[model samples]
Target: MKRILLLCALVPFTFMTSAQNSRPNIIYILADDLGYGDVSALNKNSQIPTLHMDQLAREGMVFTDAHSSSAVCSPTRYGILTGRYNWRTRLQSGVLWSYDPPLIPESRTTVASLLKQSGYHTACIGKWHLGLGWQQGENGKVDFNKPILGGPTAIGFDYFYGITASLDIPPYFYIKNDRITATVIDSIKGATGKGFWRAGPIGNDFKHEEVLPQLTQKATDYIKEQAAGKQPFFLYYALPSPHTPILPAKEYSGRTHTNAYGDFVLMTDDMVGKVLQAVKEAGIENNTIIIFTSDNGCSPSADFKELKAAGHYPSYIFRGEKADIYEGGHHIPFIVKWPGKVKAGTTTATTICLTDFMATAAALTHRALKDNEGEDSYDLLPLLLQKGVYQRTYTIHHSIDGNFSIRNKNWKLEFAYGSGGWSAPREKAARTQQLPPVQLFDLAKDIAEKNNIAGKNQEIVKQLTHQMEIIINDGRSTPGAKQSNDVPVNYLKYR
Candidate 1:
């Protein structure tokens, strides 16, 4: 009887250990300002080849209706890392500046933190626009030489090497871990080009054109180093390419017929290929889970008119570009490649948000999340594995201008009267024309959002409006206690 009891007790423990050890290494490759149509695998009419991106999609599962939590950079990143909407934070609209205090509170749980707690090594390489606590000097001047506080390391990442903000933003320099790689004692004037960066303090050896290649090499090196170790690793390789300062390397210049932007995109694709190759060469390709996605839709800074003339539509069939409440703004390409786990060459129209990363990671590790954590995140592993049906109850969309839109099932309701961004029929113009107070679209019927059926769908409008209010008031969409928003979130006044 004693011998039989011992065997029974050890069985569950052994199985649990095996499951924990079986957790694969995760590499999340996030492209900056990449559009749904940019990847050839996702868009049939793409002008750029994107061979590597296509291959990844072919070998993995493609999420056709995936979207970023927000239509801009920092906010989307916040959502990805925290598994909570950025609007819940103090930053209600726009992005954080390079010199601003850390947007992610030290107390908040991040995806990296969750993975780290699950015995995985975590690193964040590339653009970190979520903000850093730079030490302030006299007259509120930034002390670049000092070790910056409240950065990636302070939150969760064990290693962090990247830029503070977008390539166009000022104080251009590179940061390794917590300190700037080089001292910024000189000012670099702005240069003229299709992709221009703002003039600001620049490090002596920091070159804008070389940032992408350097980051790619760093990421690959990290992967190789980690592969030799026993512990699994999580690498958040945030690419700062194909965004602004479209400086493609000489070898990649003019590689595409579209324009310089296209050439930059080609370079970006090549970078992805390099990382994928690194995983293969490291012999961890099958044991690694590679997820390729974008921060948001393509930026208008890509010179849409010229690209359109060249027969390239960055937003694809979508109506608007970045920062719009429309599909084109937050809708992004999400491809996951987990060899022997996720079925190959499969596609799912199941709508998902970037904020879902937290809960998915939790589910993968078999860890239970607390009520305060992952308030808006839904576990996507079920959908990815095709084990069961997984769908979001509703997905909230936020724009650069603080516009709010809610989507439930096939119906989408935009509380704003216009695009709420840079596109035509802006807020002022719409008001001048006496457009309706709100807009509703049957996304199933009009994917382009050309026709507004708000008047005809008053019932849906009321239901969606009430649902949105409930979600906002409850402070979460997932099942939990009613939490509190970090700030007052009034959707009516565009706050």
Candidate 2:
């Protein structure tokens, strides 16, 4: 009887150990200012071949209605890592400056922190726009060489090899931890030729054009290093490609038939291929869960006119681009692949968001996260691995201008009178033409958001408004959750 009882106890322990060990390595690849229709797999009309990203989508699950929490870079990154809305933090309307202090509070729990606790090695390579504290001047001037504070390392990433902001931002250099590998002692002006870099300090070898090549190499290198390590790692590879001042390496330059933007996209595809190669070389292909996504929809400046002239619509069937509350602004290509784990050639129209990453990681690690934490994140592992079905009840979208929009089932609610965010030049001009106070669209019918049926559906308008308020007053999307008194100013928020 004693032996039998001991064996019974050991059975559960064995299952628990195996469950914990089964946690696959995670590689979260994020793109900047990429459109939903950019990938050929996502948009059949795409001219430039995104074979790598498309192969990823075809091999795994493609989330058709997925979105980013915010329609911009910094805010979206903040939401993705912490599984919390950026508005609740010190940040408000605009994005972070290159030298802005770290946006994430050390007290907050991030996906990386949770994974680290579960013995996962975490690294962030590429664009880390979430703001890193700088050794700044009393009057916005500081010792550039000083060890920067309150960045990825402090938050949870065991290794951080990326920049603090986008390429357009000043202090144009790649920061490895706190110090810049390449610096700008002299003023290196932007393509606009207006802004100037100060002469305070710069790293020895930093150059504007050198950033992309180095970053790509560093990312692949990190993957190779991690693959050889005994400890499993979580790589958040946020690429700053096909964004502003789009520049591609000589090998990829002029390689695309579209334009410079297309060429840059092809370059990004090459980067993905190289990273995937690293994964394969590591022989951990089946054990690594690889995800490729974008921060938000494409930006208006993506040479869309040029792309359209070539019979390509980067926004695809979507009506808007980045910053807009429309589908294009947040609806992005989300592909997840884990061989032998996630079913191949799968596609899920299930509405999802980057915020779900936290809860998924937490649940996978068997870490107990209170309801108040990761307020909007949902665990989708069951659906991804076990063929379980998940119906996301409600997905929220926030514009750069602080507009709030929500999609519940087939109906989408936008409370703004404007185009919501920067959709297109024509859409922006159309805002002055005509619009409703509260626009409601049955996305199943009007996927392009051409019609506003709010006047016809008063009940949904009322219900959606109430639901939006619940999220606002509670300071979170989760039921009955409220932000502490220290909640920052959420100016220009929903009416």
Candidate 3:
């Protein structure tokens, strides 16, 4: 007890204590690949109206410079859960494949586990992209009958119901806890455009169109059920919509009158509305901390050309799309609503990363994290409560190709010259065309990143590069005891 109190004392701010032994119920809603401009409240020019997301923005605090730690889905999810840079893990680039071993070690302290330790009931519904430990039979086939290992249940979630990876990944089925709810006895074919899913083995009950709705129902059901309990509950509801297999249910189809993807965005918003409605109906709205944000920027599969034709820009004036090191890839919409605790219609441009959730959660619960845990996380309670300036000094961004970029105030330094992912002037092309080896931009002067001023700004480049090296070598951005990364992170050597 003394040690715990001492650690808590080391924390920067006083613990958020609404009432004795009372903690706010937390609901974290992560939209899969939803763009910064997709929310109408964030982007004035967005053609698709995201009423639910917009409502959250209007009622809560909107962060203009919020970013996912990585420019892709899996890495961003990893950072959010563990509060450590995904590059420090074995998955330096790209996403985990279906049937891959668990990305997070069983002993790692996750946000779910942390809350659970603090006497909160935790549940995770929808999209577990951080890989699962699936047992294989002698014939090299997945043993669906055997209980899966190293999943959400192993990590600390009391309840977990979600697909293994991205909806596009193969072996489609749902897992309740560590068991497969159904058997995979069918096969599927790959698709193109908005309805894009890889061809693979599928379960008898799995359907692309029903995934979003079913997950939504599960989330609402959980909220309603948990409201009756005396214990505070933490619900990490990750929506799989508006990502791929853009199959908006019949009711939402063509609802946007712009494109299939736009209609799908509406469907996503409806899911958010349902969750919000569930909290209100349960009478927990006043005591719940609701956060709505995206894992990463909108994927190119959303048909950027078609959306542009319709005058809707998902990236919203950003230079690149998903898998990029630019603002469009990692910069995302972040809204937090806690009735009476947060002022409505407030906005802050202070830069923050998704990894900050860890320390923020620690602050809320009045628990201090050890040096090894939440290595890259910083507490954002100050910014959320409008108490003072944010504690984050700089943010490190990662691309799908493992390239690194450091953002300090108005300047950004990209280690790679090209887009680093699927954007134009790829690594090979950039090198062939004799482009600069490194690119630096003064984001204050050129938010679009049209100008590369590295030639004239060598000192700023060197300074940011040094800071990045220190952050990488120290294995943490926050002040703490020295820690070791799971693996050596060599961001300079890109694939």
lDDT of 2 by residue, 1-495 (tens): 999999999999898656644888899999888888889888888987999998897779888988898888888998899877776666655588866778888888899988998999999888888877778666777767778888888888998888767776766667787677654455553464211223323355766567777887888888888777667889998898767767767777666678777887888888888888888988888888998999988876667788888887888897788887788888888999989878899987778888888888887788977766787778888778765656358777877777778789899998677656765433345556665656799999999988989999999988987877666667667554466523644433543
Q: Estimate the Cα RMSD of every predicted model relative to the unseen true structure.
A: 3.2, 4.2, 5.6
lDDT of 3 by residue, 1-495 (tens): 999998887663444344423589999999998999999999999999899999999999999999999999889999999999999989988999988899999899999999999989999999999988889899999887789999999998999999988899987888899998885568888988779899988888898889999999999999999998778999999999789988888888777777889999999999999999999999899899999999989998898889989999999988888999888989999999998888899999889999999999999999999999999999888988988656788899998988899999999999887988888878889888889978899888898999999999899989998999999999999899878888988767853
Estimated TM-score for each candidate: 0.95, 0.90, 0.95
Best by lDDT: 1
Q: How many pairs of residues collide in each model? A: 0, 5, 0
Model 2 per-residue lDDT at 349 = 76
Span of ten consecutive residues with least summed lDDT in model 3: 12-21
Which candidate, 1 or 3, would have the higher lDDT against the true structure? Answer: 1
Residue 225 Cα positional deviation in candidate 3, in Å, after optimal superposition: 0.5
Q: Each candidate: what lDDT?
A: 0.91, 0.78, 0.90
For model 3, the stretches where C-alpha displacement exceeds 4 angstroms are: 1-21
How do the residues 278-321 of candidate 1 rate in per-residue lDDT, one tens digit apiece?
Answer: 99999999889999999999998899988998899999999898
Error of 1 at 482 (Å): 0.9
Name the lDDT of candidate 1.
0.91
Model 1 residue 458 CA deviation (Å) reads 0.3
